[model samples]
Structures are given as C-alpha cells and as structure tokens.
Target: MIDPQQATPRPDAPAVEDPATMPFPLISDISAARWLLVFIIAAAIYFFHGFLVPVLAATIIAFASWPLSRSVQRALGIDRTATAALFVLVIVLFLVVPVTMALLYAFRELQQWIYWVFEVNANGAATPLWMVDLPQIGDWIDEQWMRHIGRPGAIADLVQLTSGNTIASIYRSVLAAGNVAFHLALNLLFMLIALFVFYRDGDKIAGQIDIIGARILPRRWERLSRVVPLTISATVTGMTLIAMGEGVILGIAYWIAGVPSPVTLGVITGIMALIPGGAPLCFTLVSIYLVASGSPLAGVLLFLWGAIELFIVDKTIRPVLVGGPVKMPFLPTFFGLVGGVKTMGIVGLFVGPVLMALLVAIWREWLREIRTHPQTP
Candidate 1:
C-alpha cells in the first residue's frame, strides 16, 4: 500500500499532461504544416526570381562539365575550390576573352560605319563601286541608292522614317541600349559567382539533393537523376560539335570564296551557330556582301552550299546526337530548341531539350507500367 503522491512510475508509461496548461503546438496539423512549407518555398522563389536564370544557367553548365571537373580535380591533386578556380580561369581565357575581343572589334567597326554614314550623308555622295557592280540588279540598286542614300537630307529623312528624328527618341534609344548592356554585364557577373559556388560545393550539394529526392521520389528518383545529367551533357556536346563543325566547314568555304577575314568570320559563325537561325543569318549576310562585291556566282554557290549543309545537319546529325540519350525525335528536338529560346532566352537552349527529354521519359515509363499491369475492363 503506497500513498498516491509517492506512487512509483513505470519507465515505459506515457506521461499525461494538463491540456489547459500545455504549450501551443507550432505545427499542430500535418496539412497546415505542408501548406506553410509550400508558402515559404513560393516566397523564396519570388524573392530570387531575378537571379534564377543565371543560377539555372550555372547549374546546367556545372552538370555538363562535372565529369571534366572531376578528372581535373583528380589530375591536379587539388581541392574543389582550386579546381573550380582553374576551370573559371580557363573559361575566361578561352570563351570570355575571345567573345570580348570580337565584340570590341564589332563596336569599332560600327563606330567607323556610323561616322562614314553621317559624313557621306552630310552632302550627297555617289553610289559605291560595289553597289554599281551588282550584276542584273545593279542599275535598280544604283537608282534606289541615288534616290534615298545618295542625296543631301537623306539621313534626316531616313531618321524620320525610323522614328529617330527627335532628340528625345534618340536619347531614349541610347538609354535602352545602355540598359541592355548593363543588364547583360550584371547577369554575367552573377552567373560566374553562382558557377563558382556550384563547382565548389557540388558534391555536398549533390548528396543532400539525393537524400531529399530519394525520400520524396523513392521509386523514380534514381532514373530521373541519371537522365537529367545525361540529357544535359548530350545536348551540350551535340551543340558544341555541331557549332565547331559548321564553323570549320563554313570557314573553309569562306576562304575558297575569297571572303575577307575568313578565320574571324568562321569564329563568328561558330558563335552564332549556338543560337537558332544565327548561323543562317551569318551566311546569308556574307552571301549578300559577296553579291554586292561583284562575286555573284561565288555568293550563289556559297548560299546553296550552306543551305544544303544546314539541312543535312539539322535533319540528321542534330536529332541523332542530341536525342540519342533520351530517344527524342527530330520534331521534339526542333520544338525544344525553338520553344526554349522563345521562353527563356539563351539558357533555355539546354533546359528546353532536357525538359522535353524528361517528358518523353515519363511518357515511356507510363507506357511500360501500363503494359506490365493491364487495367481490367
């Protein structure tokens, strides 16, 4: 017999508490907690919306280059930070430097062209020899040039036609251009910083992601994870190979056609080839220049050659290389490229295809599951 106050408690007995005196539960309901989590995630994404593109681009780049990074890390016998720095350095030297140089050269050329335009248009200037020598269309071109560009006050009239006659309009255009340049620079800086972070902490980050993914998607996470990186790598590799091939082939053609600065033009074409329709624009402009410079036959041949080559590459090589991993068809790949560019600009180039590939993969998986477990009528 024991007093109630001194009774011995069992170690496994659950403790009872007074409801009135208990502290309030922070997450009393699982459903409410889930909603709270969702709200937090949405808020975070909204806050970082501007940086999303650069971060996404960096992620794609890191995924595509991870294999090389690992090898580089091993060979150099260095830590992740040092290896990542080396990669960043290499990228700056090879990619950034060349692009910057090309841009500067283009800017200089543009300045000279603008100067010439204003100077010559100050008083009507004669049609150039090139325009006057453009074969069957030469006379028509000359007539038009004399009527529009070869007369005093032509520049003003053209400016008015372009809605650039007013000082305010021109000032606005300049401001817009400057704004674009500033945004581009800002984006680049952010991308570099994000890239460095991704490279440095990639392993730890991957492991954490894997743990979370496994918990969330226990069945499909493995396949999904494998598919994403492979898809990105294949798409990037295919783009790079195609761009280089187009550049080399077109560069050789340019030399044969006696196009000035063939090497430089080829490099430019290669860069342009990364964007949809950019390569075509390059060759088309070159062909027009050739015709204007009295090389009509060469221009015609080059244009035809480019068309044929481009067709072959697009219809055959692109689908095979870019879609091989995910078994994506040509139409899907084409749509992916176009849609990606339309939706997300340059970064979409990789992301669009990856998404398409994932969609195809999931579709196939569903088909397989259906086959394995037939529905009863």
Candidate 2:
C-alpha cells in the first residue's frame, strides 16, 4: 500500500476459452425431434396428394412469373402489390384467354367441318382430281375416295359410323372438360393466393430459405439458390418465346394462303410448334389440303413459308428473347422439352429443361470449386 505503482504483479489472467474447443450443446436430440415433425408433415402431405398438387402448381407459377412481376414493378414505378396484380391480369389475358378461346374455336370448327363433310358426301360427285396428286399415299387415297363415293350406301354407312364415334368422343371429352374446369379454377385460386403471399412477403421467405440453406449446406447455399431460379427463368423464357414466335408466323402464313379457318389452323400450328420437328406436321397437312382444294400454289407457298419461318425466325428471334448470357447446351434443352412433355405432360416441357440446366450448372460450379481448393484428408 506504500507504493501502488510498484505493487507486485497479479497472477496472469485466466486464459480465455476458445469457442472451437468448447463443447456444443446436445443438438442431436433437438434435431431428431425436428426431423420427426418434418416426417409427420410429409406423410400428411403425401396422403393428401390431391390438395398438394394445386399448391405445388401455384408455387411453380409464382416462380415462373416472379421475374416478370419484378420487371413490371421497376418499369412502372409501382409497389409490389400493384405489380403483382397487373402481372396476374396480363397473364390471364395473354395465356388463359387465348387458350380458352382457341378451345371454343376448335369445337365450333370441328362441328362445322363434320357438317360440311356430310353435305359434300350427300350432294357432290366422285372425288376431286387434286386428291390423286398428294405426296405420300395420294394415289391410293384418291382410289379409295372414288370407290367409296361411287357407292352412296357405303358413304352413308361410313358417315353413320363416324357420326356415332364422334358423338361418343364428344361426350367423353365434355366430361373431361368439366373435370379440367374444376381443377383449373382451383389452381387459379391457389395461384392467386400464392402470388399475393409471395409478393407481400418475398423478402422474409428468401431470408428463411437462405437460413435453412446455410444450416444444411453452408458452403454452397448462395450459389445453389441463385443458380436454381436463374436457370429456371432463363430456360422457360427462352423456350416459350421461341414457341410463341413460331406459332404466330405459321398462323400468319396460313391466313395469307387463304386456308379455311385460319384461326383454327393457327391454333393447331401453335400446338404443333411445341412438338419436335417444329411445324412440319401441321404444314404437311395444310399443304395436302391446299393442293386437294385446288390451290397448289398456296400449298407450296405455305410449305415453304413454314420451313423458312421455322428455321430462319427461330434462329434469329430466339436469341433476342432469351438473352444470350444464359448459355445452356442446345441438345439438352431440346431433349428436356421433348422428354419432359412425354413423361410429365405439358408442364414438364418447361420443368425438364430448367432442372437439367440447374443440375449441370451446379455440378460444373462444384467441380470448379473443388479444383481450386483441395481438401485436407
């Protein structure tokens, strides 16, 4: 106490404990309990698969439209809610309305065609001369048509059989349509609900996702999350734009060639564009009809138009729609569309390519990271 500045030194301060060396809490028990809860919920969802499907579809639609919604908000200087509403409205107008109108038009055209064929059979003479000039089996088809029309009783019997089948098919189709309408209504409702929630609480949801990703896969979380949405958006936007452009061109060509029921043929062409080998099937049928109906020039022109539009327009316009920065291999993208449609119906057409692209990107990035930093054994 005589000289405080020269007092004896105290014992060294106790060494601070390193967190790396400290024992962690027994989280295994908590983790197991949490897993059990998750398993129970999964089981419930599996049991109620019907309820889950619409919810899943809603989620997918929200994801697909997220980019557009954001763009709308930025471009229009609007709030998220307004942007989402406008986005949904536009989607309904462009996608749902067009498809519904097309279906109605198709049904009307089908009925009219059936009636026209019956009238032609009842009053007209033998087969037209142009039937013999069609490409593959034109001669055989003409011969059969002449033979069948020569016998009015045979034609009547054939018409009766066809009419009966058509009626039955229409009945079945109507039932299916009723079911589809119900499901579509449910899906639309859920989708709107999901869209609202996503727009309102997207940040919170993203944060939660990031947290979960960090907990489960701390190293690759950011990369995985970004790549998934990027791949999906890029692949979907690219393929859809290409298909739509092709459809419009083919439709215009058909209209210009004076094809009977241009709208109906255009709708068919759009559907055909979604298929592999592009619009060849529709063009071939249109050409045959044109030639048989005494417009060989129109037929040739339509065929050429289809070929040129598919090859030229697709190559030229697709890159513009889907910005070239998103580079995915074309072959995989093509197969993804075809195989996805074959396996999972129409929706798969978009999903398959996105999934394949995401997987490829993830693996590539993972390999690069590993090559850059070798792990210690």
Q: Name the Cα RMSD for model 1.
A: 5.9
lDDT, candidate 2, equals 0.69
Candidate 2, 1-377: lDDT as tens digits = 46988886678867778999989876787898999989999999889765544454445556666777777788889887787677667767887677667667766776677565556556645666666666788778877886666444555656457675543455467557757666656756765677677766676887998998989999889778887776666655665546655666777788899987776777666655554554788888888789778888999989888888766755766667565535566576667667766754444544566667777788888998899988989
Which parts of model 2 have CA positions greater than 4 angstroms off? 1-31, 51-61, 64-68, 74-77, 111-129, 142-171, 325-377
lDDT per residue for candidate 1 within 47-158, as digits (tens), equals 9898987787788778888999999899889999998898878777876666556555555555565666667667889988997876798799899988888998786677
Poorest lDDT segment (10 consecutive residues) of candidate 2: 50-59
Q: Estimate each model's TM-score.
A: 0.68, 0.68
Please report how far candidate 2 places residue 224 from its true position, in Å.
Answer: 2.4
* Deviation of model 1 at 207, angstroms: 2.0
